[model samples]
Target: MTLDNQHWERISAYLSGDLSQDERNAFESWLQDSDSNRLLFQEARLVWESSRIKLRVKNPATEEELLKLRARIKSQQPAGRIIPLFRNSALLKIAASLTLVTVAAYFYWTLRDTETVIASGDQVLTLYLPDSSRVWLNTNSTLSYTEDFTKENRTVTLKGEAYFQVKRDTAHTFEVVTPATTAVVLGTSFNVNDADSATIVTVAEGKVRFAERDAAREKDVVLTPREQATFHHRKKTMDRSRSRDMKFAAWRRYKNVQYEKEVKNSGLYLATQYTWRKNQINQSVIEGTIRNSASLAVYRDIVLYVTYSQPGGPQKTSRLVIGETVNPGQTIDYRRRLLDIFTETNVLHVKVESAEVETGDHY
Candidate 1:
């Protein structure tokens, strides 16, 4: 039986689990119609398995072997033996081996040209590049680098806003390419915002060479710390100015503070001081202060795990959420009433479970 594009698509969908139950049943019934159909399906499964193999390291010498195999297969293929299912078992093995080699060659070619992509949606994301450089991607941002990154090149393409702390490499300068402009630096921390109609570069440390995408070297501006540059897409013009405030990179600092708080929150940076008592109505009343000890971090949305025990019974844990903010070395007090607790219930422990860093985006 000869297979068309639709048959190939059906076979692929069946293997990938994309067919519905009814469609799957019909396809299986069709597969049972003839011996040739079963043989073809088996060959297709072997090809699918070959495609799933992960080829991490490519050997350059395999190109010659692949070429020789292709030539051998081509010489053996005749119009009369196009399907080859009825052929001898030895020829069938050769055909399967050729399929595997073809898939391997395709993977090698694709991996050589593949790019590493990192994107963020509603929340911020932090990533480390192959060169050990750190990047904080803001909401709706995308960053991609080629496979040759940190080896033959140290360049990245950006689509929204991101803060980059590029590693110092004197020999290879790091470059950030946007639609309107490009920023190059040896080692620096900077923010790049590529919006709808323009691209902005704000330097926090070191120096950045900001220029139009297709501009001359002389037209590029070297911006030092606290300097900003803008490139307008419509007019294709570039401008430079000094920024008094460093709020352009506030997102990076906010994310870093949150990360530090999470890393040091286990009885080190955040602590709870509280007192609990039984009210007149026999309800549990808890009042306390959540203190942030970090010198530069602010925390909010504190969630406390309250563990209580009944008279001669097992302990039960309840969650309490405090919609408050605690600054560095500052304490925020909160009061919560537990109405479901029994009159004789005792408060055993109250500990800070988690808290979110106060991130106010100024950009």
Candidate 2:
């Protein structure tokens, strides 16, 4: 595709890692939309890097060839005879100008598309797009975009959950793509969570155009602030309602504003200590006791994800249910054996996953 100057600037920003989360995600979505965009991005990157490669160390064979060229030049000319080519400085300047123009045109044509992918594994990540828009990706989430982002339309593909604070761009509309739904807006802040059970879209600020992802006969609705919509995958239905609780986007807000508070009061922090012992069969056994620190009883299953890492070696992470229906102030024990041949586990990152508050009575 023939891209304009705007596309070039976007690609430049992407290469410099200056794209915001929304822009980055949008650009990657454009990239996935076509293989040609991807190939163009790759070629542009190679060309951009090739310019720097010129400054690197030269091959010995190249130096030898240069010496041979110099020797041939010296032998071809008569003694004390000035070269005709060097005598015409005007011709030399014209040749230099033509060469510069050729290289610039080549780059302008080749480097028009770019792609970016961001993944938040255990912790949340905040990023800015080329247009200075901001987006925050939740844990275990991914976002992607392409160079054409914001140039024509601001679009993004998201997996899992994300909180977006898009910059105002009246000329172009911002859109978020998920497997279940597509959210369209113009400079608005919203929260999108696409989980196995359902895809939830909550408008924290401004309005959002939420639509189903069906190719044929798509359905859409406008969601106002404090309103949330749920697209149930199993039911193949979309439900919209005014949120009963004001914390419709509490999960995203918690990660952004009260992460430290959540960490301090969470169940993982309530585990006062841990014990590790080697069994008779040479397997390492890890043990820890977690307590329900929150006031609400945890009726749903709470899993503790632990990452085992050794110095200068690959890391392995595994999840196990620490407890189910842990009442307030109740404690539960966790024990697991390491089957890998790792001599010692040096680094351990423990966090709670899949935690839910029990609404009904849990005796």
Candidate 3:
């Protein structure tokens, strides 16, 4: 029997024991009318079971094996086949059918078809975690997670600043990976800022272990609360600092643009803010954006320099370091002034780091 919406619904209701006595009798009679209906019902249940096998990784089965089983279903060449009548005799089959339904319901409710938010300067975002760990994203940063995040392991890769207040789950430890550092927490609270390779992990509650990425590009090291770990991605060096930002701990309360914290770039490849007040960098107040249009504001005579080991060789190293912010669109003799500044200050590859704010001069 070809199953339509109504037929599927009837089959589902009968399997779930939702059908009335009269409806159940009718379904049983209908079930006997066509062996095709019975075959289809079993086929659908098996499909549900196969999808859930991934969640129960303890049991292993390949798609090819399942497909072979599906092919064999056509062999209704009934030899030893028997449909038990007594309800007690069908207990195991009923349990398997209910499990398929339960898993299908869970997949429908839990898997969110979305992407992670990675904000930059003065930006805010919301993140939905697999274990129901909700994160309030701050600005000048990026956050990303795959839909299949928990299939193998509970992990989310990130770049450029955001704070996390994790939900505890002992079965799987949540790991935050940055280019320079790794913050591993099972159920604690912390802030992980990875802006242009200047990675900082500050723990507020419980504990977290901070470490560098392994040669296989996996997380290493661990950390505890009231401690802050800093690392430079390119330099491959670890730096430790005293915890100053106490607010980095809180979760519910958030930041609204007062334009505080003049964060030092600290050889930060991307622009960032740092304060020496020995104050706290709360997990609640972080923000920023990646500037695609604003690579640099035209300042001086843009001297294009390239290192050539030989003729027509691919240029090797480049640098652009700006002393401070300048008025936008101001023309500069990059040749006479900018190159001289590069020679004297050793800061070259400079770009305009500006932000667009609606109704304010915050950026």
Best by TM-score: 1
Model 2 misplacement above 4 A: 1-113, 214-218, 253-363
**Which regions of candidate 1 deviate over 4 angstroms?**
1-113, 253-363
Model 3, position 273, has a per-residue lDDT of 26
Tens-digit lDDT track of model 2 for 189-255: 7889999989999887799988776323246889988789998888888899986665544454334
lDDT of 3: 0.47
**Candidate rank order under lDDT:** 1, 2, 3
lDDT of 3 by residue, 1-363 (tens): 233333334455564566568656765765565455555655554333222211332222444443343344444323333233223323334334443334334323333333343454564555667777756566655666655556544666676666676888887788776644567778886778776767888876787867775322234445666788788877887777778666553322234221111121212123332111111321111122212212122122121221222244433433333332322223222211222211222212333343222121211
**Local error of candidate 3 at residue 207 (angstroms):** 2.0
Candidate 1, pairs of clashing residues:
none
**Predictions in order: lDDT:** 0.70, 0.62, 0.47
State which candidate has the highest lDDT. 1
Candidate 1 vs candidate 3: which has greater TM-score?
Answer: 1
lDDT for 324 (candidate 2) = 58
- TM-score-superior candidate, 1 or 2: 1
**In terms of lDDT, which candidate is stronger, 1 or 2?**
1
For 40-147, candidate 1 gives per-residue lDDT tens digits of 565454334322222443452466664553343334323222232222243233333334344445445554456667778776777889999888888888888766
